[model samples]
Target chain A: MEVVNRYVATRHHVEGAPTEADFEVREETLRWAPDSGEVLVRNLYVSIDPYQLNRMKRSSASHLAVDGVLPGQRITSYAAGEVVASACAEYAAGDVVAGVLGWEEYTLFKPSPGVLMSKVDAGGGFPLSHHMSVLGTSGMTAYAGLFEVCKPVKKGEKVFVSAASGSVGNLVGQFAKLAGCYVVGCAGTTAKVDLLTDKLGFDAAFNYKEEPDLKSALARHFPDGIDICFENVGGEMLEAALANMSVHGRVALSGAIAEYTGEGRRAVPDLLEMIYKRITVRGFFAWDFLPRFAEFGVVVGGWVRDGKVKVVEDVSHGLDSVPAAFAALFRGQNVGKKLVKLA
Target chain B: MEVVNRYVATRHHVEGAPTEADFEVREETLRWAPDSGEVLVRNLYVSIDPYQLNRMKRSSASHLAVDGVLPGQRITSYAAGEVVASACAEYAAGDVVAGVLGWEEYTLFKPSPGVLMSKVDAGGGFPLSHHMSVLGTSGMTAYAGLFEVCKPVKKGEKVFVSAASGSVGNLVGQFAKLAGCYVVGCAGTTAKVDLLTDKLGFDAAFNYKEEPDLKSALARHFPDGIDICFENVGGEMLEAALANMSVHGRVALSGAIAEYTGEGRRAVPDLLEMIYKRITVRGFFAWDFLPRFAEFGVVVGGWVRDGKVKVVEDVSHGLDSVPAAFAALFRGQNVGKKLVKLA
Candidate 1:
């Protein structure tokens, strides 16, 4: 069987903030054979993430962790799709699956033990888009980074989340609240900030753009000092958080969207302050906690079903919108988990 | 009892690199009474450390961790002394003790549960100067920072030490070697570098001053990447180490002597690299491990006795040498532990 696949590819290496001009829709032909032991997937919902910007660059430290995206190459992302055809016994036609797919109409995979792809449980009563958002890498990252890396050691611990309205940050704020923490978050826009405090159960929220000095802003919000900082937007925000951290504070580096765009300066925290405070800063990814993915799914899935955790998603239509959807993430235009849905 | 106490004190707030001119020797008459419940001690050996520079500054983050040093006031330091008179039952005349004594000829303290002072076991079979060096805070800081903070998880893990010939750095190199780690260290001078490899059992040592680019130097030395970085000299050293760290690397911020004296730029580590490599950077002081002081004393004391770890001490004579001895630390003029043996 052969199919025409339309995918979004970078027009050139994205060195700075991403725009629609930096990406293009590319065409490809994918062939599958019955005895090939491969699975063919019809992509449904593909994730638009900030971290992808790093991979699009010509050279980046991020390339060491995730495969770099070459110019005009198919972009791989955390996506949900339907297995339209399969030669592998583990997957059959009409089965839904989610893991690493592409920002294209279709994806072909040869299933193996090392494959990130996993069959989405059909019996799970939730929207397919949730698998691309809350039940996906965003949820996994938020869970692992908050619970495992920066665990709230005490009840009512002050938890500060940067880029709080972003995919993982929103979930982190909600999770921190559930763990009995005094959670405060910061976003770029007033609307996003309102969404955090009013809709997302954040104790308080602020527009980072309005603050002249991030350090003073954090000091004002967290008078007692931040106990656990879930760092998503790095650079100045990280520097500010480090300055206002409590003794033995834990900072979980989830993402650094600010630095990825090259628009913000890299954080240069006072090393002496870190020593005086005994701060522990750790960098981690959702894959680091892959063994606990299923465990997280059950707990987070239940929260979504019971309305204990609200899932906020902003999705664009068709593969052609992939460029705009991804570009919007860098601008902080997306209110929540940004996604690109197939036509 | 009446005694004239002469001590070294800062003439003014030291905001930059310290010089002998920044300090002065002042005399004061102290009258001790039995009803005062104060234990009077005649200072013997006093510790001159790099962190004290921060305390002498008008304002610094170090003030949060340690008591700030006011101009013309006696600066408290880690010292060993002989009790002259005691109104507290725990101490008596001729009893040797060590802890938070002053950089003066005499010190008076009211013994309480919160007092840092501890009686020195004369039968411990070490010189009194050793109490201010290996068996004191320097040894404790090295033990806690290496074995506790940046613990070598596996045998033969690559360990990198900066400011390798300093009091704590020297001990960390020796300890890392004993822990079965492949250790490399960087120092400012060729002599200090030679001491690391030739005398300290380090696998490799280099003069950081000779290297034009620290990142390239570290890459050449740690081709396999550093697993544990015992950072004493921060700034460029920290940034270089982060760039060349292995997956899940641990960095224990024991000291940042480079930045403390305003001689080096603040390290601005790539946040993306930290996340990609899953690095853990922690800042800590020896006081954080005060609970295990006795435990560390037993273990480290055994190593020093068995010749498994070498004790290095650099002592200056008289209270008048305090300023010069303290200033020498910033210039890297002293080897091993810098101390002032009072006359």
Candidate 2:
């Protein structure tokens, strides 16, 4: 089988704040043979994530963990799709799957033990879009960071989440609340703040842009001190959070979107505070907990069914909108998990 | 009974690099009565540590964990002494004790269950100075930080210790070596570097003062990347270590001597590096593991007796030299554990 695949590619390495002009639609032919041991996928919905910006950079520390995205190359991404043709026994025509697909209309994937792709049920009652949003990398990141990295959380403990309206942050706030914690989140806009408190069930939400001194802002919010901080923004926010953390506080260093674009100041947390409070700051990835995916799925799936977790997603249309959707993340324009649905 | 007690006191709150002029030997009257339930002791050796500088500061985060040193007041410290008179049932005249004494000629103590004081055998076959050096807080800190915080360390794992000639750092390097690790350490001078490589059994040693770029220096020594870092010096040294760490690296944030005096630049580690490496940075105090102190003592004591570890002690004479001895720590003048023996 052969098909023309149109994918979004960076025209050049993005070193600063990315714009839609940095990306272009490039087309290539993808082929699959009967004995090639590969599956041909027609991508339905591709995930637009903030981490991709780091991969698109000219050089970055992110390259140490994941492969860098080269200019004019088909960027590998997490997406949901249907099997158009199969050269392997595990996947067949019309079977729905999710994992490491790409930003193209079609992806030729080789079946291997280490491959992230997995067959998801199409008749599972939940929309296929849920597989790309609430049950995807965003949910996995939240569950792994909260349950695995920051464990033994007691009920009524204060939990603070930065970038609370964003993909991973929103889910983290929801999960913390479900775990019987007092959740507080900070976002850039008034609408996102309202979305967090009114819709997402965050106990409190505030606009970070209005606060000049982040340290004082955190102190005002957490008078008793934050026991667990789901850190995503990083930079001065991380510094402020550390300053107001309680003794034996735990910080899951999930992401640093503030420092990713090279504009924000790097955080200089008080090392004395860390030692005096005996805090533990651990950095991890969602994939680090991939071995327990089914276990996490069983738990999170119940939340979605019981209406305990409200799925928040902002979707754009077509491969050409990938640049705008991605650039919107850095601008804080996306309300939740940003996804691009193919036309 | 009443006697005049001469003790070292800070002249004023010190906010910068301290000098001998910052301290004075103040005399006060001490009274011990049979009805008062107190014990009188003649002070011998008192520990002089770098952490005292923070206690002398007008205000600091250190005050959160330990009490601050008020100007012109008796500064409570770690010391060893011989009992002169006893009104308490737990002690008797002529008994040797080591624990929370002070830098004074004589101390009047009321023995309480929560008090840190402990009776030591005068004929224990080790000098009293050893109690203040290797068997004191320094040994406990090294043991807890290396074994407890950075745990499950495999044999042949590379370990890097900063401030390698200092009290805790020296012991950490030695303990890591005994744990079957390939250890490398950095110190301020060539003499200290030689002590690490020659006297201490470090696989390699370097004068960090001579290296223009700490990141490159670490990379050159640990081409395969550092698995464990026993960080003592913070600021730029910490930033560099994070940059060159291996996947799943562990950093025990024991102390930050560099930032104590507020002279050094604050460390701003690249968050991307920390996240991509899946590192764990934990801050701890020896007192946090006080419950296991005796357990650590048994293991470390065996190593000491078998000559698997070396005890380094640098002592000054009398309470008059307390100021110089404490100030010399920031100047990197002390060889190992700095102490002051009262006359």
Best candidate (score: DockQ): 1
lDDT of 2 by residue, B209-231 (tens): 89999999999999999999999
Chain B only, TM-score of each candidate? 0.99, 0.97
The global C-alpha lDDT for each of the candidates, from Candidate 1 onward, is 0.93, 0.91
- For candidate 1 chain B, which ten residues in a row score worst on lDDT? B108-117
Against the native complex, each candidate's DockQ, computed on alpha carbons, is 0.86, 0.83
- Residues A270-322 of candidate 1 have per-residue lDDT tens digits of 99999989999999988989999989999999999999999999989999999
- Docking quality band of candidate 2, CAPRI definitions: high
Proportion of native contacts present in model 2: 0.80
Candidate 2 wrongly placed segments (more than 4 Å): B121-124
